[model samples]
Target: MSAFLRSRLLWPVVILIGLVALNVAFTDHFLRIQVKDGHLYGSLIDILRFGTPLILVSLGMTLVIATKGIDLSVGSIVAIAGALACVQISDLDDQNSVSGVLIAVGITLVLSLALGAWNGFLVAGVGIQPIIATLILMVSGRGLAQLIADGQIITINSSPYKLIGGGYWLTLPFSIFIVVALVALTAFLTRRLALGMFIEAVGGNAEASRLSGIRSRGVLIVVYTFCALCAGIAGLMISSNVSSADSNYAGLWIELDAILAVVIGGTSLAGGRFSISGTILGALIIQTLTTTIYSIGVPPETTLLFKALVVTIVCLLQSPAFRKRVARKRPRPPVTQTPVPVSDREPVTNR
Candidate 1:
């Protein structure tokens, strides 16, 4: 039992199970399933639906963290993507058509790629710190988005656009399908190739990896690019959901949430290791926790406080010092002593 508990996979599994149990206990019919419009409906389905964007961002985040880097500009990129997409659609009268929507999505994708390249160049070529580099975008991307939208929220009345964020297929939200597809693709790429190992090696020791001819700079660039692309995808989903582009709130504070999800999933902030499955689980946990809070009628003002407390507890539990203290508190078996009557008598005679 002790050996099983100490296994690396045990904690994450336990955490996932515990969260599921908590949701079942606290929420009314947490996993209850129903049919609507010939589609499945349930709280679990809702959790996945809402969690898609976070899961996407965290997937990219896992890669960045594995390369010992961070991207704070994802939220901004999301804003930028939405803004660009809306601006493109605003110029067209038939914004509800397939062609217009495709054009907007394409434009957003291109812009996101360029923005990612800029971040990658700064971090990899100019030797800027990842946080500082991304922070610049985090601040400027919104401004850029606002500029594109002419400081107005561009309303989109497009079926295709709505489908991106709010549509359903086969009794499940399309966003959920997108997230699953991306997760599977990412898992395949990382697992089937040398990318995961290379990223981990670079994060573990950049100098050593470079010495071994791993092209660390190139890896960093790719990581940033991937992060930006994920942010772009998330932007599409969010903007589509509202059928409007509001740069101000499109993806506000999303980067922080992604970071939290990654950390909660047991991915080290300091880097060198990552877990895609764990990140997906972590995203679900966050969504479920949020739902649980709202279902119980917790005030909006106190939600942040509750989330903070949960994060604090999870972090503390993961701390090495806490683990060591727990280990020290465990009882040790006693040793028994044997009698030595003959030896005691011989020693007395010698004295």
Candidate 2:
């Protein structure tokens, strides 16, 4: 029990459960679930539904951050992906055809992979800093999305495409299955395949990893590509759910949220060790916080401020150094010993 309590996994789960309980206290029905047309429906289900995109983005960001890198371009990638897919679907006469959705998805994913590779090249091949490399796309990706979308919100009525985001399978949100599959696959690839160690080594010390025979460049390229891929899938989900692609607003500031989730999950930004389970918990926390804001009637202007405040407090709470300092005992002032003992002992020194 002690060991379990001390585990890094403990706190985040506790915090998430606490937040859920808090919501329950306020709403009184936060956990209640109902079945409608064989689909589970409730606040909990809604959280899972709405939180899926953020979860995917944050999960990808986890790998990048684990390599001591950050991808600021994920939001833009999201927009581009959704825009590209929607454009393809909108151009098709048989909007509801599964083939149209499949082609669009395939094309979008390939494009996303290429974009991710571009980031990898700039960083690994060109030796540019990861932040700088990703920033290039971060700034330009939105424009590319707009150019593809022609500065218009392209709406489609593709039922098959919408299923990716809004459909239910086995009475649960289909996105839940996607998130679970991705998470499981990531765990397998990282832990089972030993890629996690390579990533950790690279992040812990790139030169050391290179000298030790790990292909650092390959790792970087793979991670960055995977990150963009995750963002692309998220873009699809976003566009599909709404049946529209608004490039301008599709994934605005999602990178920040993803980073926030990664940080909250207790993953070190400096890179090294990471926790996928922790990241999932962090994403849930973020979604919960967002939900709590509106349920509690926070003003629109102050909502972001409130989120920042909460995040700061949680980060401080999670910081070992900060906690240690706060919990440390103050140094007792050096005790002043009277010199009288010397005089008192002088009589015994004759021997």
Highest lDDT scorer? 2
Error of 2 at 185 (Å): 0.7
| Runs in model 2 lying further than 4 Å from the true structure | 331-351
TM-score for each predicted model, relative to the true structure: 0.91, 0.94
Residue 9 error, candidate 2, Å = 2.5
TM-score, cand. 1: 0.91
RMSD score of candidate 2 (Å): 2.4
Q: Write the per-residue lDDT of candidate 1 for residues 164-241, one digit (tens) a residue.
A: 878998888999889888888888888889888888998999999999999999888888888899999999999888
Clashes of 2: 0
How many clashing pairs does model 1 include?
0
Model 1 ranges off by over 4 Å = 1-9, 330-351
